[model samples]
Target: MDEEQDPSGIAPLLMAIAQQDQQSFEQLYRLTSAKLFGICKRMLVQSSDAEDVLQEVYLTVWAKASQFDAQRGKPDTWLTTIARSKCIDRLRLGGVDRHTDLIDLDQLPEPEKIDPVEFASDKQRLDNCLSNLQNQHRTVIRTAFLDGCTYHDLAARTGVPLGTMKSWIRRGLMSLKACLEK
Candidate 1:
């Protein structure tokens, strides 16, 4: 079984969290916060907004940890679902107008137009760099960053070990960063 699915892993931590153990809560946050933050950032697209929603997500987790049941689902999935739900809620409420006076729409500045040739050049450069990677690294990097699959998800889907998947992604990202910098 994957460590994520092992009873001694996140499940035990969550069970402790359910019992109001502060240390377990801290451990859970430490273990899962980065993934949760990534999810928030992807959905919200603003660092501050994502950070605010992440805080709300953890608060919800702390309040609702007792609601988590191992039989129903894995702890990671439960946490991911909560994060998604909170992000969606934030999006839903985001449409409400807080301004007392409405500004004239005609007074707004024109949106900047991106140069398609420049955009395509960047994309082609990235594609070239990706083509230079080992096939597994390229595939894993694309799936994780482009598709937003979590490490556990990628590991389970690819039948690879979690640590290996993490290493692949880390190295792949570093290579991508180096390539992009040039």
Candidate 2:
């Protein structure tokens, strides 16, 4: 179902699950398992491993259901986030080798096309703003935000001090904000 047509019943089910309700948890798995499984399969690239990760995802949900904050994000997004993180962890653990040859670009479905005019304008604006950043600032900001590296991770990977890394990101974001506001 399209997002607009999908029911909002998942929130209530999550709430019940938070309270240790088995029936509600079962209902939630029945409703979202297919979607979550698809995410796992796409990331892991193996059906058996995806099935294993999906089970781990639900076990995590069962344990951390109370941590779900509806005000922070929707139920589906929260679940998807959990599944994605679990998949990444599994990938990092050497469950899957990183090889570009394993993927066939031609076999992938085409991406939805965007309006050319809007895309050009947005890309130009973003490029202009990103260009305003100093070399180190730009690298730090892009690595942290785009690559999803934590501050400590960035510091360790680049051999820069943690405080220095944070300073670069903070200053870079401020500069980016001022540029984008133009």
Candidate 3:
């Protein structure tokens, strides 16, 4: 927090604060608060809650900066990791699901009724069968079947025609079924 410290020196200043330097701590709070708050706001999506989490992350950073061993990663990653962990902790404690904006149950497309026991059975068999497929086909199937991509998103992402994507996924499913039965 030296008055002449360049913008990139915040991490070292943070390191200084770990040794209990109050002046550096104040300067870091003043310099990095707005950027950190913006990032937290984007992540948490609630101003007051984000502010609370921000405060908590800083307190954590102050208390835990000594835990920031540079060999593991850079300082930005260290600080951001603490911030992200704290926000997740806040969300967990607040009992708010991050996916609250997910499709309403009534509005969701009905998923295929795969028997969970059978589907979860013999994962190795499934992987081996999937490995037999070409990477492009395997990728499309994984995205559509396992990851639940829609026909449109799959088409867009894979740059395949909608019908072709559907066909690849359908054929991939049939192959998997035949392989699993064997």
The candidate that wins on TM-score is 2
Model 1 spans > 4 angstroms off: 1-4, 95-182
Q: What is the lDDT of residue 71 in candidate 2?
A: 73
Off by over 4 Å in 2: 1-6, 97-99, 102-108, 112-182
- Inter-residue clash pairs, candidate 3: none
Per-residue lDDT of model 1, residues 71-177, tens digit only: 88777778888887877677667752211222232343332333444334655777778777767777776555433456776787677789998998889888988
Give the per-residue lDDT of model 3 (tens digit) for 1-182: 33232235666776799899999988878877876786577557778877888999899988987787655655655666777677666655765423223222233332234334423344456667877875666776654433334667667766668898788878878887888789
Model 1 Cα shift for residue 148 (angstroms): 13
What is the lDDT ranking, best to worst?
Answer: 2, 1, 3
How much is 139 displaced in model 2, in angstroms? Answer: 19
Poorest 10 consecutive residues by lDDT, candidate 2: 97-106
The alpha-carbon lDDT assigned to residue 9 of candidate 1 equals 70
Which of candidates 1 and 3 is the stronger one according to lDDT? 1
List where candidate 3 sits over 4 angstroms from the true fold.
1-7, 95-99, 102-182
Least accurate stretch of 10 residues (summed lDDT) in model 1?
96-105
Residue 147: error of model 1 in Å? 11
- Candidate achieving higher TM-score, 1 or 3: 1
